[model samples]
Target: MTATTVDMEVRGPWSLATGRAFWEGFAPAALPAARGDDLTTVLLVEADWSRAEASVAQDGGTAAITVDGDGDLDAAAAQVARFLALDVDATFWPAVGERDPVIAEVQAGLPGLRPCGFHSPYEAAAWAVLSQRIRIPQAATLRSQLTDRHGDRGAFPAPAVLRGLELDLPGRKAEYLRAVADAALDGLLDGLALRSVPPEEAIRLVQQVKGIGPFAAELVVVRGANAPDAVPHHERRLDDEITARYGDGATVDSVSAAWRPFRTWAAVHLRAAREGRLHEFG
Candidate 1:
């Protein structure tokens, strides 16, 4: 089988926040590789051998993507193009009104905020389950380890591959992985199948996993399945960021109230803030 690779740039009136959000959620690692230090408004694709890498440099106003695999290059490029097109639409824009002062401030400073969604429910669920109640860096580390240990070496693991893997980690980490593995084996953690189910059912299905709770389950629904209105409760990092920014008065309802229909956007902004992209919002 022959493999093909292609590179393309997505162009438009661009926003850094939107670009980062889309790339981070969809093609996390590739964004850095393709764009380097340039702000990407375009998507770059390199595809071969049934695998692909996508890159975006928001500062350069372009995204670089690569696809490789035993498949049609055009089809892979189309998929990359679809993801890039979504970022340019209002679907990814965070709705902000003048009513709330803080949101108004955020909007006034950074007018390009947008609403973005995830493409893979299974990956989202797995990420959410692994991220529960941990620091972002720590969670990322654990996820890397999980992928390295139980997942396929070059590509992400299939859900079936994770089903019965014996995960060895130190102490509590090991316990958590085993629990997730058990859920996968028992068919209780079917994120791909649950995508077709209603949000409520999907939440129920994911929560049946040992370590997954309402918070993690809801996050999977929102961040994984792209259920736009799914609100995440019990997210400690979110709460902490609110407190640090707005002080003790940053109650969940208070901090998130202004976001209304665009709470997910707010969540993404908080995440960006953590990543030292606070200037991106402005």
Candidate 2:
């Protein structure tokens, strides 16, 4: 396939090099070529349901993307931007550190780090289903099995494909996966729609799906839609981190006010730091 290539301007302080560390460690859905400085992956463009082999590398303020597929190139580029958080204008992210010392330390530790997310809300929902009640390693193995059996290349299966399959997964996960696919096809899982509203509203809406609950809904909205400012209210680890970093009286509501509109970034940073410093290790 002839590749359709484009160069996208990434706003604010960003680095594929620094962000690669997190991607390499992110286990829900392993990123392609995450071991390298550049990012290479097979993306399932939700706009037209076309599969593309995409490679992205950073040069200064721009992300150069080369895509080989028969889908909408514009949509592909936009999806790539969302996936890598290039669409977010994080120029003032550094300023968030000035207010909070912990944030400052985390920023200093993981400079130029942007939270990379699932390719789309559809995939995130699918992962939420797969991961429930299972260890990450087991879930990852199941995801790999599903991909090998049904996905195009390494991309997760399209909605129609996933919906049609009678998967042999544990519990009622297969039923839940179909429900997720149904939501995706019905536009309930569109990234734009999910990200357009308040994070709370998005979570509420996503929970309407059969298998999605508060935790899964938050996963879809905050990480799946890649809402830059969304807070993970249900994350126990974040709560623990807050108590450990701040005082025992510290709470997410009290401390996160300092985080402001970049709350998601702060939350991800805290989690990464708590999870053994992916930035430094990788």
Candidate 3:
């Protein structure tokens, strides 16, 4: 197929480096190809999928993600936007920082870093199972194997396409992915399904699946749904990181109040800071 290219402006604060790092942070093989400031990925926007190459560069206060692809140019551009988290409302940063002093310090260093996430909540849920209880590298290998064997076109399998397939991961992980794929195909785990209730209740709904747990459900909410206020607190409520800052780990939900409407974004940056370093997964 002939390749087509398009360009879209990524408004607000953004950095190509942090975007690429977030993409490759969890697993490189599952994400796009990042060379310097350029990124390339096969994306699924709605029904159409495209193998798109993009160059993210500064444009005054904004950035431009120029996309070249063999599939629908418009769809590819939207996918690129979703993958890089370009459409998020970052105007809440100022209010968030003012609400809490500690977040202000962390936000100072981690500008232009959005969630940097998966294509959709369904994709996030599938990945959560594949990577469950395993290191990222292992998850990448498993994801690659599944994609190569079953994906119609692109680096990751589509919901309907993956529903009929299976993987060799431990226990019911593979089956769980297929189940969620079915749910995705049925739109049972879409944004509305998750957002219909509060984040915590949504976690319970997600845990209805065979393999998903509290941590994985939280992941689905943040990464899959790109939920602004949601934090993966199931895995981290009293870690030294929050206690050191807020002086009360028990009040994590209250502590996160300061980062209201952007906790997912803050959580990612805060975790990276807590690690003491940001290693490029690329």
Top candidate by TM-score:
2
What is the Å distance of residue 220 in model 2 from its true position? 0.7
Q: Which stretches of candidate 3 lie over 4 Å from their true place?
A: 1-11, 28-33, 48-55, 66-73, 152-154, 191-205, 248-250, 276-282
lDDT of 2: 0.86
Candidate ordering by TM-score (highest first): 2, 3, 1
| Candidate 2 local lDDT, 20-105, one digit each (tens) | 76776788865655455688878899898889888889989998988888888778878888877888999889889999999999
- As a TM-score, model 3 comes out at 0.81
Clashing residue pairs, candidate 2?
none
lDDT of 1: 0.51
Instruction: Tally clashes: model 3.
Output: 1
Q: Give lDDT tens digits, candidate 3, residues 37-79.
A: 5555665544353345555665555656566656676665655
TM per prediction: 0.61, 0.95, 0.81
How much does each candidate deviate from the true structure in C-alpha RMSD?
6.4, 2.0, 3.4
How many steric overlaps are in each model, in order? 44, 0, 1
User: Worst 10-residue stretch by lDDT in candidate 2?
Assistant: 273-282
